[model samples]
Target chain A: MVIAAIGIAAAAALWRRDGAPAVGAALYHAWELFLFIAPSLLAGLLLAAALRQLVSPGALARWMGAESGWFGLAVATLAGALTPGGPMAAFPLVLVLAGAGADRGALVAYILSWALNGFQKLLVYEMPLLGPDFAIMRTLVTLPMPMIAGYIARRLPIAWEPPK
Target chain B: MTGGQVFLAVIALVAFGFCLRRGPGSARRAVVDTGQGLWKILPIFAVALPMAAFLAELIPADAAVAWIGPESGVSGVVVASFAGGLMPGGPFVTFPLVLAFAKAGAGVPQMAALITGWSIFALHRIITWEYPILGWRFVAIRLIAAAPLPIVAGLLAEAVVAVLPIGLGRP
Candidate 1:
């Protein structure tokens, strides 16, 4: 937060030096973007929270545990993609899954899926800003990443353990 | 409102309804969580949107085209990927910058690479969120395992564009 504040302050100073009109333009653009995204952001958070309540850790673990194999990876990937919120919402659920005995591979896959192709972000932000074509193309290109990464993580010689 | 916003609103309404049916406690929890998430995200947006506006105003379309435009090719993708990792903030900030760059004439492949790199190697996310929550070992392994992804995706996107240029819908 502090860093963001400092950045804004610095940018404001730079824009002010550039011209009063520039400052006004920048502020106007920011306000417009905020208004555009505010509803989606709020809805996304609510959806994420609701999901957290709906899906139990036991179910998450069962669906994405070590013994669940490729199916587990698929489930993890889908769950990660479907999850609606940011890292704060996703990571705690991950921690819970880890505690409930999800494998290292599943965990890694879950994180990668969320990072690369989170459905909520794609729908709310990416598609909206970048256009549906760009969003779809990117999604197609990235579809395999989480699974590939998960497979590699599973096969790596390193002794991978769940985060303590 | 955009189609995406309408879609999100529907999802939110359904989720809220479900939570409400589950219990008042659940609905309250959702509200509290939403508040916290908003708090975390707004500051980043506050800074990033202005930065994007500034970039949009300052950078020329031709310069952006020369650097990360289609003619710039693989090198442009590499540079974009690196920039994406270094960029701080969440999607609210990152997407607008990409939009700015696109409007300034960045190629689709470069944009793809940028988004990929931002997703995987964002230093802010790695340091502030992933490490603290998942621990160093997991983070390291995941980083190493996924290192080649953005570049590969970028290259593939470039190839796809060459074969079926219309499919990518390049700006």
Candidate 2:
């Protein structure tokens, strides 16, 4: 609602001089971007749906464990890889997973990866925003972020459960 | 089937799956219920799609590039990542500004770093959305946990490009 109001203000400001055309132009531009990512977003929705049904959070946490010592971090990174939303989108899910007994390290990892390095974020958002080489390189660089996040969470004072 | 056809089929299947999940109702009732849920959101999507396009058009790409492009280097990456912390809006809002940067001579590494930073490091979002809902301790821990990840992402990308053979110029 607040966001819509702001958009209306912007559109209205632009409208003072020429209302009809400004809205049309803005609408057209929005359409183009939507057209670009709709396929990917729809697919992301489907995959999310699949995940909701197919895997329990505990099972997801367990499968994500790659190294015995670094298990939490690895699992988090893997979780990060598949998750498709930006940070805001990823956080609640991270909390839910943690609530369900996912390791804190993994939760941090998943959160980092959820926005910075997910397959969907990379493929859909990054590729277009930064171009292929840029997107590809960034993904490569950030690959360790979630793992490192997990590692730090494991070592640091942060608690896995929400701070009461 | 072609990927397109397969995708269409999947869409249909998802709808059917949704119907199955709805329970012992008539097929007509199930379809109506499902349609109503979907119908509610369609107009909002219809409106948002273009507004983003205008924002994309309004923001000048060259300026964004100048501020956070490859020329900025590691410091640039750190700045970009943290600066990204203050932005509001979705990936849709975020990507266009960064895309503008990439088009204007930003390095691949830096470009990647900035985008990653922008998406995840948003503090406004953390405080506004996550904190209020989750509480002080949870929010603080989450934010504290958040800081180092983008840096790690930047450094890791650098290391991978250095150690692994990751370029495309054949001998």
Fnat for each predicted structure, in order = 0.53, 0.30
The stretch of ten residues in a row with the least summed lDDT in candidate 2 chain B is: B162-171
- What lDDT tens digits, residue by residue, belong to model 1 across residues B18-88? 98999999889878877786687677667766776666666676778987898789899898888888988
Q: List the residue pairs that clash in candidate 2.
A: A30-B49, A30-B50, A31-B50, A64-A75, A141-B157, B85-B121
Instruction: Report per-prediction Cα RMSD to one decimal.
Output: 4.2, 6.9
TM-score of the first chain alone, every candidate: 0.70, 0.60
Which run of 10 residues does model 1 chain A get worst, by summed lDDT?
A1-10
List, residue by residue over B1-171, the lDDT tens digit for candidate 2: 224324533754675566457553533454554345345434555544444444444455565556655456677667766766666776655665454344444444454555666656666666666667556655565556667656666656666656643321100
Model 1 chain B TM at 0.69
Count of backbone clashes, every candidate in sequence: 0, 6
